[model samples]
Target: MIERKKYMSLLEKWRDKKVIKVVTGVRRCGKSSLLRMFREKLSDNGVEERQILEFNFEDLSNEPFLDYHVLYSHIRKNLCGDRMNYIFFDEIQMVENFQKVVDSLFLLDNVDLYVTGSNAYLLSGEIATLLTGRYVEIKLFPFSFAEYIEALPDGTPHDTAYRHFSEKGGFPYTVQIANDDEMLREYLTGLYNTIVLKDVVARRKITDVMMLESIVRFLADNIGNLSVIKRISDAMTSQGRKVSVHTVENYISALSDSYIFYPVYRYDAKGKQLLKTGQKYYLVDTGLRNIINGTKGGDLGHILENIVFLELARRGGEIYVGKVDNAEIDFIVIKGEAREYYQISLSVRDENTMQRELAPLQAIQDYYPKYLLTLDNDPVVLHNGIKQMYVIDWLLQN
Candidate 1:
C-alpha cells in the first residue's frame, strides 16, 4: 500500500487529542485502510497492543456485540486503568444507538476515540447534537493523481499514469488491479449497488428505487451542466415517471449524504450574490461514473472538472462554481485569505475555445491567482495574466 502521507499527516497532528477523530467518505474510498494505517502508526510509536481496543462493526465476529450496551461493556472490560487507552471503531454507525456509546466513551478519562463511517447521517443532527463541539472531522477521498503516480511502476510515464487515473479513477483497490479492467468494472459496479441499496435507499426508506436510480443516472449523465430539482421533476414527469419535485429533492439529499454525489453551489463573485438554485453535481469518483455511463468521449471535459473539484475539496478549499456575468468560471477555491479561479477544459486548440476559456477569468477584477488548465501540452498563455498549466503538472504539484 502506498502510504497516504496527506491523511497520515492529519492523523499525526490530531493524535491523542481529546477531540473525537471522525473519518468520513464514500464506501471503498479507503476509510478502513486509513484506520488500519493509523493503528500501525500507534504500534510503531510503542503503544501497547493490550492498551488499544479495536472493533470493526462490519465483521461477522462482532455481530453479537451490535447492541450499544454490549459494545460498551466490551470496551470497558478491556481498558487498562493505569494508562491511557486508544479506541478505534470501524464503521461504528452500523451498531444500534452508536451515538449513546460515543457519548459514554467521551466521558471516560483514559480513552482517546477514533471512529469511521461511510454515511453523513452517522453524524447528522442526533450525533451532532450529542457530541457538539467535541469532535473533529477528517474526510478521506480516493487516491489523488499524485498518489496514483506513486503507486505506478518506475518505468511508467506520467501521461500513461494520468490516462489510467482518469479511466480507472483513484480508488486504491482499483489502482492495484490495473491490469484487469473487467475486475475493476465489476468492483466498481458492486460498490455502486452497495452504496445505493444500503446507504441511500435502505437508510432513507425510499419506496421508489427505480426513480432514485433514474435520477442518479440523469445526474451522472450530466455532470457539469446546471441542474435543479424542478427541472428533473418536470423531465421525469414528461417521461411518465410521475415523481414529485419534493421527492426528487429528498432523493438528491440522500445521495449527497451517501457521498455518491456532491453538489457545487454557484457563487457570483462580481455581484457578490449567492444563488440558491441551479447547482452542478459532481460524482465522488470518475470510475463509478464511467461504470454507470459507459466511458464516452463527449463528456471528458466534465470528468476532468469533476476530478479537479474533488482534488480542491480534498485540499481543504471551499469550492464553488463561479458565475460572473454571463460567463462561467469552472471553479472558485478559497483557503484562508488566498483565493484561486480556475478554468478547466479538455483542450484549447481552437481560437474561439481559447478565448472563451480565458474570458471569464479576465472579467474578474481581483488580482488573485488565475489559471487555465487543459490537456494540451503546448498551450499558449494569453496576455490576461492567467497562468496556463498542463493538468498533469498541476495534479502532481502541491
Candidate 2:
C-alpha cells in the first residue's frame, strides 16, 4: 500500500488525543488501509498488543457485532484500563446506530479511538448528533500525483506517469492493474455499481436505479460545467424520461453524500460571498468517469481543472469558482485569512490562450497571490502580477 503521507501526518498528529479520529472517503480510496496501517505504527512504536484492537464490520465473521450493544460490550471486554487503549473500527457505518457504540467508548477515560466510514452520512444530519464536535475528521482522497508516481514501477518516464495519472486517476487499486486495460475497466465498472447499490440506491431507498445512473453519466460527462437541477430535469424529460426537478435534486444530493461527486459553488470575488447559482460538480475519481463516459478523447482543459480542484480540496481550504466582474477564475481557495486564485489551462503557448487565461487573474484587485497553471513546459513567467507555472511541476512540488 502507498503511504498517504499527508493523511498519515494528520492521523499521527491526532493520535492518542482524547477526541475520536474519523477517516472518511469513497470506497477503495484506502480508508480501512489507513486505519490498519496506523494500528501497525502504534504497535511498532511500543504500544502493546493488548492495548490495541481493530475490527472491520464488513467481515462476515463480525456480523454479530452489527448490534451496537454487542459491539460496545466486545470492545469494553478488550480494554486495558491501566493504559490508553487504542481502538480502530473500519466501516463503522456498517453497524446500525453505530454512533451509540462510539458514544459509549468515548466516555471511557483511558481510550483513544479511530473509525473509518465510506459515506459522508457518518458526519452529517442526525447520524452524527451523538459525536458532534467531539471528533475530528480526516477527509481522504485517492492517491495524489506525487503518491501515484511513487507507486509506478522503477524507471517509468515522468511524462508517461503524468499521462497515466490523468487518464486512470489516483484510485489506489488502479496501480495493481495499470497495465491491463480490460481488467481495469471491469474493476471500475463493478466498483461503480457497488457504490450506487450500497451507498446511493440502498441508503436513499430509491427504486429507479437507471435514472440515478443516467444522472451520474450526465455529471461525469460535464464534470466542470454548471450543474443546474432544473436544466438537468428538463434535459432528461426531453429524452422521454419525464423526471421531476425534485427528483433530480434528490439524486444529485445522494451522489454527493456518497462521496462520488463534489459540487463547488461560485464565489463573487468583488462581493466576497458565494453565489446562489452556477455551481459545478467534479467526480471523486476520473477512472469512474471513464466507466460512465467511454475511454475516448475528452476535454483536456476540464480534466486538468478537475484534477486541480481535487488537489486544492486535499490541501485544506474552502474552494469556490471565482466570479470577478464578467470573467471566471478557475479556483478561489481561502485557507484561514489567506486567499489564492488559480487558472488552469491545457496549454497557453498560443498568445490568445495565454491572454485569456491571464485575464481573470488580472481583473482581481487584491495581492493575495494569483497563479496561472498550464501544461506548457516553459520557465515560470509572470504576466503582470500573475505567476505562470507548469501544472505538472506544481503537482509534483512538495
Across 1-398, the per-residue lDDT of candidate 2 in tens digits comes to 78788998899999878899999999999998887788888888999999988888889988999998898889888899899998888998888888888888888989898999988888988867778778998999998888999998889887788888888888899899989999998998998889999999999999999999889989998988988888899889999999999999999999998999999999999899989987999999877888888987869788889989988988889999999899899899998999999999988889999889898888888989999998888999988878999888898877
Scored by CA lDDT, what does every candidate get?
0.89, 0.89
Residues 1-398, candidate 1: write the lDDT tens digits. 98899999988898878889999999989988988988898899999999888888889999977898999998889899988898989898899899888889888889999999999988898679888888999999999999988989887898888878888888899977778989889999999999999999999998999999999989999898998889999989999988889999999999999999999999997986678879999999988888878877567888899989988888887888999998898999878787899999998889899889999999999889999999998755655689988888888888
RMSD of each: 1.4, 1.0
Q: What lDDT is reached at residue 170 by model 1?
A: 89
In candidate 2, list every pair of residues with a backbone clash: none
What 10-residue stretch in candidate 2 is worst by lDDT?
124-133
